[model samples]
Target: RHGMRLDAADQAWHLSTPTPYDPPLTYGGWNQCRALGMRIASLLDAREQESNAGSGHSDNGTKRKKKKHKVVIHTSPFLRCLQTSVAISAGMAQFEAPKDRTSSSRPRTPSQMHSASPKLPLGSQKRYRKTKLRVDAFLGEWLNPQYFDHITPPPPSSMMVATAKAELLQTEEVDTFTPTTTQRTSGGSLWNGANNRAGSSRESPLDDWSHVTNALLHAPIARRDRSNSASSVGSNESSGRKSPFRPKSPFRHGHGFQPLTSTMPKVEASTYYPPQPHYAISNSDTIPRGYISHARVNTVNVDYHWDSSRHLQEWGDGGQFGEEWSSMHRRFRRGLNGVMEWYSQHGSEERGEDALGLEQVMTHESTDDDDQEDLVVIMVTHGAGCNALIGALTNQPVLMDVGMASLTMAVRKE
Candidate 1:
């Protein structure tokens, strides 16, 4: 459960609230979420210690079993949920060291040996392997397009690509500007210095670099066109066709040429300096594949909460004063069942078994002297969904308030 936080403006609108803007989590909400995560980790630690004390020691008191703790975190795609997961992960990490924290007696790698030290520092060479956090996009607010639109096409122009790269590479300065409608629609403005219909140019000052380079490259091509036209006129004058050497603009759209857009602040250059030559191919073009071809694809299934039911007009107004609550409850239970099935399947695959009960799959404990294992699953979700789930699990209506970032614990007892 997320802690106490104000709703986003969009959420407020859906709820018919007066506020029009989404509000971020208050300072208290943020702190509460962090504290809850830390508390959960502490409680788990104490429980593990108690279990070990009761089961691990032998009668002779000469031998004791060892244990390990593992935490698996799952988060909804919502920003608040993701933030909560981060807070929880930080809390859990504070209690444990990396599995490879021990240093070798002697340097294992040649690079380490080359250094003056004969042994690596503790935790210096250790690779801390924690369970990968899973983002359940399906768990996002229902009917939100953000989670569904997984494939976003890149900008079409090379100029835009270069500008984006420059922005990424030069973080010390802001090198990008919001693109105008003309820049997005008309490809010709990039090649020529012609102003759009607005009569004002929004080009970035960095475009001066590209303009100087292009002018130099175009000069030679213009000259060659002139020479060819002069020679062709004598032979083709009788045909009455336009001259080929008329020196037309070579920076046509779809010619594989990318125009540079202005983004950075203006810099003065010497008038006497020769204009820089523009290269035929841009850095983006040199890449082996197009943006769409190299787009990454991820297959994930998320389970959103029933609070998303608010999106349905029929479910609004407290689901017609609790009359529609049963429908909402059913939806939530179905989604939760799907999640449990997935966990069961995943556990089976890992253990090479046919299937495992949800409790057995989610809860892990180890008693081996060389290995200690504990598994914790943290789920971040909406208030309505959290309350409903707790009610179903405990077989009663939720009596406690579920605030933003608030936490509820359920431990399976053997």
Candidate 2:
């Protein structure tokens, strides 16, 4: 009942024997995520009120700027995870929607530009502008052949991208109009063309994401081709095998369904290799049957500015055949570091004005007087991945099985 969005019989079948097809969240999962989103909103609302009450007066004799509460959602590119984010965004929107602001009721701070409505009908749901959700490859489920009886074929980047938009379109009135050249070009170049300053002293994991994000947003198949060609050129001269290490995909997973290359013995071109997963996904494939239409495309509400690098993927050379426990720790540590960087940039008053588009950034210097508000980051991933993230942040293993749509918080005190 809590797994994939399949019929009771099919769901049971999948539970016993997992399928290769990427499944969307169950109806129950959607509702759970929305409730979780509301809880988060309530927590943030309380914190904001407390912060406002604590500040007495400004030393400058002038009114202080009102702080705008910001929430950024980073989610796995998997169908279920993306759907979870959409539902969470909807929940937050519903919670924050002002109730009778025109009357005597106290107005909700960080007012919503969207109309106040408890439930948004499908195909007409308005976009929740206050929260920005991004699909992050690093947050994807652990991908190693040894974990399962059969390796799950990774979904194509385009299909994942398309499926995300389709889900948003049905549940949240996303812009389904054709994308402009600027919108497409901007997203594509940010990742493929950005410089990776891995060696720089001040460099953060954020610098390595432009390429991966670009692939996620636009021309992923093309990027795959380029990556393959580049790898071929750098093949080991002695053995004539592609280099096990690829700078673009420092980690084994996340970059779509391209052939994997490692120090392990390579399968002969003539030898038949069983399709690792029960089914193989190609560029022409669509979302699982009965899922939303994978035709819509939205670039506005989903930010592509800061995606995680393939370097942070769950498995790689660090963890031979599969991802070792230590590799999982390192993976989440790097992911946490990158997320902290995102939090810092977003929390700062100097965040790029362009990046604040559509997001509510209330800062009235006239009547408002408060310090900067705290920023909230919602990360969507698998249950075990949740444990890994908790392990990374807390430096202790709770060894508990994380439930579906469960929220585990780690507050940063500075």
Candidate 3:
């Protein structure tokens, strides 16, 4: 039943099989198959050991010739046959994955050439282009051989490195400028008047909001009329200031909606209490959905400062915009009155957690185990075929690290 036969003339066992032979791989059959392989290995090992021992002892003048008898030896011609077969299919060595030719019923789109869905390419994934581009995709920068042939000396008069390019870069830097501003302030009544009109109910903040805004609109005109009439009546009531702050906002958001910007008055830097300073955010951060931040107005100058020690204990952290700029950098620049100010001020302890919660979200998501390690060998007959197949596998990222070739090399060396 096994695929092996003896060739008496050649004095070896040769592997013989039915033309369309198929080996068993069921639970019981796999064990039998392994046992057959183990038997062949043992026979080969015994022969090699005997050959080495015989050579060492044969140096004596009285060497004994091996006994010739009518021995029914189970010489393995199968090993020689398999070695020939292996040499023929050497480059075709590969792990055969079961193919499912059936197609899925799901609709296909042009964006997806196959069933694989493309990742959203969201959040920290954007940074991979900047951080891992050299190691990942070469883009215009792969160091291949075609360009290496053109090494040349530059023209003698050229000051290439230090003088020419350096001055041009510096000139571009100093030439740019921004307009300066003078600081101004609105009366306190403008903000205080709006703040008093807090929404009465989550469903109905508009009614209460209307009362506060009405008083604000009338307050400005009332003074103008009073001042002109005061000129007629000869009194100093108009000389006094209207309320510095006002109740202004009817901040209302519900059913997954944010408060409208119209509720909050926009202040220009020149007209604000103190001029707002521009904070440079070198890192771009993505905001998690539904992160609420209480905007605690800082007493410091109008420039935003996200003070970690001072404000974050009270208000929640800033939304996507307020995350750590550089986790690698030990220092954090908190904006006291800016975007960072709003995020760290929220009180909820379990706040800002989101969909992308795992470390894999920030790292390379997959590792190919075969590409990371090697395989085990079954027989000495696998030597030549294993090398050719291994060369093919090594060239492909998908097929690499199959150490079967190394096993074949070790067998040949032995």
Better of 1 and 2 by lDDT: 2
Candidates in order, TM-scores: namely: 0.41, 0.51, 0.13
CA RMSD per model (angstroms): 19.7, 24.0, 34.7
lDDT of each: 0.43, 0.53, 0.25
Score candidate 3 by TM-score against the native: 0.13
Off by over 4 Å in 1: 6-24, 55-65, 95-121, 124-131, 137-324, 348-369
TM-score of 2: 0.51
In candidate 3, which residue ranges exceed 4 Å CA deviation?
1-95, 100-105, 109-374, 380-414
361: Cα error in model 3, Å? 35
- lDDT of candidate 3 over 1-414, digit per residue (tens): 112212322221123433111111121222222234334334443544455455423556644443211100111112222222222121111112233356655667866777675454323221100011000000011122332233322211122212212221221111122544443332333235554323223232322344666676677533345436434332332456433332223442313223543333443221112122243321111111111010001110111111222332232121221223131011111211222233235311112332253322543334333221111122221222233233433432132233221232222221
Tell how far residue 37 is off in model 1, in angstroms: 1.8
lDDT for model 1, on a 0 to 1 scale?
Answer: 0.43
Q: RMSD of candidate 1 to the true fold?
A: 19.7
- Compared with the true structure, what per-residue lDDT tens digits does model 2 show for residues 1-414? 012343222434345435444666555555567678778777777776666665555787765555546677777767677767766665666575334456546565555536565554434433333456666655666655565454355654444555555555563232232322321122333344465333232133333455666566775333234356553554443356556454445322333224546554433221111112234443223233322221112212565433244333222111223556666667666777777865666542233434554333442122223446457778888766787788878888756777767787777889
